[model samples]
Target chain A: MEVEKKQQCSELLQLVIDGQATQQQRHELDEHLPKCECCRNEFELSLSIKEGLKSRLKKPNLPSELATSIQSKVLELA
Target chain B: MSVGESMPYKSKDKQRVFNKEFMPHIDAMYNFAYRLTLDEDDAKDLVQETYLKAFRFINSFEEGTNAKAWLFRILKNSFINNYRKVSKQPNKVDYQEVESYYNSESVDEKITTDLRVETVQHMIGDEITNALNSLDIDFRTVIILCDLEGFTYEEMAKILDIPIGTVRSRLHRARNLLKEKLVNYATSMGYKDKRK
Candidate 1:
C-alpha cells in the first residue's frame, strides 16, 4: 500500500501550491521533503519568489485629501 | 429617436441633480476609471464626465437598480467611445502553439502537492508587467480582470459583454503564456544556476 501510494504521489511542492493535493498526497510529500534536500530548496525558493511578487503588488495609496474630497463630494448629494 | 436619445442634451440643466446623485460614487468611479484609463488624471476626468452623463439621464434610472453597475456601464461606454485610439505595436503570444508540450499525465498527481506561492510568484512578477503590457487590448483586459482583480468568469463575460466560453479560453491561454514566460525568467535568473 505504501509503495502504491508512493508511485502515485506528485511533486509535493507544486501540489501544495495548486491547492489540489489531497491529505494522502500531503503525507507522502512530508515524508519525501525530509529525505529530499532538493525539494527543500524548492520550497524555500518558492517562498521567496512568492513574497517578492506579492510585495510588488501593494494597493495604490488613496491620498487622504483625495479621499476627503471624494467623500464630501459624494455626501453632499444625500 | 428613442426616449434615451434626447436625454443627454438636458445635462446642462441637470448638473446639480447629477452632483447630488453621484457625488458619493466618486472614489469607486475613480478606481474603475483608472482600471480603464490606466492614468489617474484621466480616470478622474472620466468619472466626472460619467457623473454628468448619469445626471443627464437620471430620469431613465430605475428606482431600485444596482447604481454601481449602472455607473460602471456608463464608464465603460465612455472609454469605448472616447479613447479608441489605434496603437501600432504588435505584442502577441499565442499559447495553443505550445500546448502540445505539456504532458498531462506527467504533472504529478500527488494529493496535496507542494506548489508554494513564493516559488513562482517572483518568477512571474519580473516579466509579468512587461508581458501584460504587450498583450493586445482584449487579452490584457481579461488577464487583468481574472488574474489581477480576481473577477469570476461570469462577471467578466457580463463586464466585457462577451460569451463565457471566450473568457474561459482566453483565461486558459493567458495563464499558460504567463507560466511559460515565468519559467523562462526563473531559469535565466540564477534559479537554475544554484541547482547546477
Candidate 2:
C-alpha cells in the first residue's frame, strides 16, 4: 500500500511541476506533500533541477549567414 | 482547406508566409537542430533543408496557426529522414532497447532519493549541458521538448508522432534517468550524500 502511494505521488508531483495538473490535482498534491517527506524532498529537488536547466543553459543563437543562405536557396526553388 | 491539402496561395503569398510565419522561428529552430545533431555544420544543413521544405510546402500551412509547431514538426521529420542516416555516432541505442531497459527497472527510487537540491544548484552550465547531451537521443529529446522548448504533451505527441500517454511516460522516465546521471556526477565530484 505504501509503495502504491509512493508511485501515485511521484506521478502527481510531476504533473504539478509541469503545470499540467488540474486544480484538483494540484490541491491533492498540496495536501499530500505535507504528510509525505519523501515526496516533499522529491518535489523540491525536481523544481530546482528544472529551474537550473532553464536558467543555466545557454541557448545558442543561429549563425549569422544561415538564415540568409536558406532564404536564397528557398527562392531558387521557385 | 483541411490539413494535408494545399491552399494554392499566390507566389507572393507563399513568400509572405515564409517570411512572416516561419522566419521568426529560425533561431529556435537552429537551437533545436543543434541539440539534435550535436554538430554545428550538420545543424546548419538541417535547418536549411527544413526551411526549403517549409517554403515548398507553404500551401499546406494555414495563416495565424501555430507556425512554430509546424516548423518544428518539419524540422524533426527532416532530421529523422536525413540526419539520422549520416549521424557520425553509429552506436545509437535502439528505441526498443531503451524502452525495455526503462521498463524493466524501478529507477524512480534509485534516482530521486540520492540527489540533493544543493548539489544540483551548484552544478554549472557546462556540467548540466554535458549531462543532458550524454543521455540517449530519445530521452534527451523529451527533456528538450518539454523543459526547454515548452511544448505541451498534446503538441509533443503531434510533433513526435507518439501518443500523449507515451509522452508522459517517456518524460517521467527521462527525468529519472537525468537525475540518476546528475547523482552519479555529484558523487564522483565528492559531494557527500547526507542520506548515507
Best by lDDT: 2
Query: What is the number of backbone collisions in each predicted candidate, taken in the order shown?
Result: 24, 0
Task: Tell me each candidate's i-RMS in Å.
Answer: 8.2, 1.9
List model 2 lDDT by residue over B1-196, tens digit each: 1266656889888888889999999988999999899888989988999999888888788888888888889999999899787776446556576566545435666676788888899998888888888887777888988888888888888888889877887888788878988988898888987668
How would you class the docking of model 2?
medium
TM-score each candidate: 0.52, 0.92
Residue B55, candidate 2: Cα error in Å is 0.6
- Candidate 1, residues B78-117: lDDT per residue as tens digits? 8776754532434333445424322232222221133333
Chain B of candidate 1 achieves a TM-score of 0.58
Superposed model 2: Cα runs more than 4 Å off: B88-106, B194-196
Clashing pairs in 2: none
Indicate the fraction of true inter-chain contacts that candidate 2 also forms. 0.65
Q: Which ten residues in a row have the lowest lDDT in candidate 2 chain B?
A: B97-106
| Best candidate, DockQ | 2
lDDT per residue as tens, model 1, A1-78:
143333233234544543446798778778877886545655554444434433453334334466455445544543
